[model samples]
Target: MSQQLIQGNEACARGALAAGCTFFAGYPISPSSEIAELLARELPPRGSVFIQMEDEIASMGAVLGASLGGRRAMTATSGPGFTLMQEHLGYASLAEIPCVVVDVMRGGPSTGLPTSPAQGDVMQARWGSHGDRATIALAPGNVQEVYSLTIEAFRLAETLRTPVAVLYDEVIGHMREGVVLHEPTPEELGRRTAPRAAFSPTFLPYEPDENGVAMLPDFGRGYRFHVTGLMHDERGYPTSDHVKVAELLERLERKVEPAVAAVPPERYRLEDASVVLVAYGIVARTARAAVDLLRREGIRAGLLRTRLLWPLPAPALTEVSSSAELVVVAEMNRGQWALEVERLAGGKTVLAPYLKAGGSVITAEELAGHVRRLAREGVAVS
Candidate 1:
């Protein structure tokens, strides 16, 4: 490992290469374009392919196709571009293609801010794709975590044979930090296990092998199969039968839920604290600073920083919720994770939110003050 000052987007691009990514397809978007720009220069000399697609949709589609063709593939975009990629995101989910999508989130409903920081896309990262489907999203607080989590995102995509989204705020994406980026070992690279070419007529394309996930066959590998956006059967054909649709849905959920459970929770100073602060991404960095300030002020405050966002780190958050008198969710968005903690806490504890949106990053002092006021008056900052 070598310590170097690197920006998060550059780290993400390097992480993709370390994960054995062979294809990059994306349109340049702010706060994320660096990932594309870096990869564009790095990949070709690496015996990999880099493509600038016409739009986000095409970029995503090309990435899915690349993955299906047995290449580890990825695409990067921001809020507006992420919105445009949702349809293909849905397609990747239903088709069971393995790819990684990086969303360096900015302020948004649409074009809210192009060059500023915001964590407003938490819910969108999970449910932006139209139907009921399972998704994996990872958020990293700093450049180092961004590098590691980007590798983890690709690993999860290949291991679970599903598309995984890496969510980071604009602040983290553009900011530089000192990072030790170790080269991945062969095992750590996590290349997909290629399935044997199905030459027999009886080969079932989508039939799962006990893990609730089907082995993905490389394109042109003599495997005959259909890939579509519709609800598919074990053979990958479009199926509208109620029973088949229900079964497919359950299988998809089963494949993803276990991976979420297997991700280790990250806890800080929560072992003996009464007030627990919960956060993720760059916002979590501020929340950590606030925890230190609160402890210095003689308040028993701790932090539950979650890197995995889609699964919501419910068990860990709920554990903290159960022990704490109050749980404060600090974010760059207006109460996205706060609402989730409220639902998971379920009357066990009071949930407070310190939220900011539209490119405003919440300050450490503001969060510490919120914790102090809550401890003194038993109230959330409004």
Candidate 2:
């Protein structure tokens, strides 16, 4: 439990250790490879497992496999690797496995920039895995956040009995900043409760207690419950019945939505604003700096820094945007998460996209200029 200057990637690895992650399976890719390198060396000594699979596909498969074995598991990857993991992600979602996936987004439609930073995968992290099932994700704005959010990811996964994503840009993924490493406090929240006892001769996997989070039984713990990606009933048996599918999906979503009440993030400063910038990850941090400069210049602009990217936090954003005359979204990628914001905000708000491609950072100076230019021209973002 100490603070030190560390890279975001290292913070993520250390955060995993603190979050009770005992298994990691990853494929080396830019931006996120450092997390793997550090964990490979760090985890074994701590009685954890680190695996580098042949590719991102197997990397994802291994983590899911390990999670079933009663270990807190994780995986890290960049955009390409993340893209490849979509199928397994869907599997993790449907199977209701508890684990974390950290995606350090680099610029890309496909390998657009390896060593650069981008927030291109914001939408993908939420919906890239094909399904109607809700996925939760967190976007960290700094190195310390990478540490904190990784723990949150696992906590959400275990509590909801679902896979969760920790979203980061290459900048936050690689940038060196101060981080406080420590074990999560009991009051900090954590994993879902497992079954007190193993299954009987007839075991049911989909049976959930009052909260709707099914008790996850550890594989080979004398528990013989069958798990499959197909839609299943409370008995864990494949159910083609319409009522079974409807009920299963409803339970999956309900388990997560209730947990959001405990994971509120900073609003930055949207208290009384005419114009606001909605941002996440590194761009949000830079945008925070930009907002300060705007305030100093007497502009009533504010920032909405999202800690929770998925589940979208619609209620909070709607409340913040309601006070704004216009909302500008800054991201390293072209309006990915911004689109989601727009959908949630409806048409009551103006929209401007400060988008960048390839690999780069959206500096405070650049954002300040954008705010000034738009304000001077009286051009509402649309």
Candidates in order have lDDT scores of 0.85, 0.84
Candidate 1: regions farther than 4 A off: 193-197, 379-382
Candidate 2 C-alpha lDDT tens digits along 251-300: 87777785456557677667777778888888888899988998888888
Model 1 Cα lDDT, one tens digit per residue, 162-181? 89999998889989999888
Best by lDDT: 1
- How far off is residue 42 in model 2, in Å? 1.5
Q: Which ten residues in a row have the lowest lDDT in candidate 2?
A: 258-267
Report how far residue 223 has shifted in candidate 2, in Å: 2.2
Count of backbone clashes for each model? 0, 4
- Deviation in angstroms for 355 in model 1? 0.8
